[model samples]
Target: MTRTRFAPSPNGPLHLGHAYAAIVAHDLARARGGTFALRIEDIDGERSRPEYVAEFFADLAWLGLQWDGDPVFQSARLGSYVHPGERLKAMGLLYPCRCTRAEIAAAATLFGPDGPIYPGTCKHKQVDPEGAAWRLDVAAAVALSGPLEWVDEIAGSQRAMPEVFGDVVLLRKDLPASYHLAATLDDAADGVTLVTRGLDLFASSHVHRLLQALLDLPVPTWHHHALLVEPDGRKLAKRRGSPSLGDRRRGGEDGPALAAALRDGRLPAGISLSRSLHTGA
Candidate 1:
């Protein structure tokens, strides 16, 4: 059976942009007579809140999206994230990284899919692993994988080139797992066949593909859909304090009616396709 998932980090309220992504995933699964699942990416203890998790259910319920069973949360599955990182480490693909953000910015000379490619400052250093992040040797990983490829429903076949990302972090200093490690592992564990997410994260798929190969996980198809943006074409992100669905709900707006509007390509006055938004933002 086909399975598609909508994994949202419960750091803030669900906004119009989130609504679009969720609707897309839910509809895509239903179209194929498959199952739609919801996953809560609440691994970031600093930002994640229990109330936000409740709000997520409320927003999805308000959207009238029927998902499979209860939502799977990342916080509750920290143990699952460890084995994959350890596997990579056991293969000598991971090294301790004590380089701070400023240190990396000062050392990086080339730009990758996401910002300055991390210059391997700690790759050869004798950094203590006690409280340091674990960095993946991307080049070594690719060497082990021996050329890789994954497909996206919209963009078609993609040649995996995680080298551009330089040595990416697999384990964080404060946390047990990085976004790349936890997300990649969780998707495989949940048996997600189609990964549906925003266009901004499209580049991360390259790194994820490499991880999947290294960990011997099943490959899944991807759909990096266009995003909903503010009137000025700015990406509507929670970090920017984007307006939330709760605002609309509180205003007595009809959830299903709003969903219908979205389906008909009729978005609210201020929200539209992000013509100017970059994919790697």
Candidate 2:
């Protein structure tokens, strides 16, 4: 049986963008006669809130999306994230990073399409400061994985070479698993054959693909859908209130109304594509 998860970080309210992604995942599972699972990515204790977490479920259900199994919350699955981090560490693919935001900004030189890349300042140094971040040693990760490739439904065939993103961060200094670490592990563990997420996460796919290779896990097909944009084409986010699902809900908007608006391209005014994408890219 095919399995896919709609993992959302419950740091804020589910907006129109969230609804689009959920609908897409739920629709695909229905089409394939598979399972759609929900996972709460609440590892970031600083930002995650109990209220928001509760609201996330209400919002998805409001949008008429359903899951096959009980929703899994990452905050409760700390142990699950540890094994992968240790596995990569055991293989000597991970290293301690001590660069501060200021330090990284100061050192980064070559501005690539993805913005200023890591400059390898802490790559050679054993600078694991008291609260310093950690990065995967790209060279070691590549050696462990050999080479890699994966298929993306919308982005089509995708490939990554280690030279692109050197030693990425798997765990933060605060001991919480980073997004890449938790997502890759959970997808593989749940037997997710395909992943449907936003386009903004396109670059992060490289990091996740690398983790799959190192962990020897099955690589799921990815579909980086287009993001729901505001009238000015700005990405919808909690920081912007008008497009927020929470705001709309409080303003007397029901689930059916919201979902209909999204499906018919009526919600948020300028959102048109009936089958458009929901990626952050």
User: By lDDT, who's the top model here?
Assistant: 1
Tens digit of lDDT per residue, candidate 1, span 3-97?
99988897888898889899999999999999999999987867987788888888888888889988898888988777777878899999998
lDDT of 2 by residue, 1-281 (tens): 66777888877788778888888788788889999999888878689887887788777876777788888888778888777777777777777888776777688876543556779887788674567777888877777677777778866776665455555677888765787788888888888888988776766777788888778788888877777776666667777774666667678777877787766667555754322433222
Best by TM-score: 1
Off by over 4 Å in 1: 275-281
Off by over 4 Å in 2: 112-114, 272-281
Q: What would the TM-scores of all predictions be?
A: 0.96, 0.89
What lDDT score is found at residue 173 in candidate 1? 85
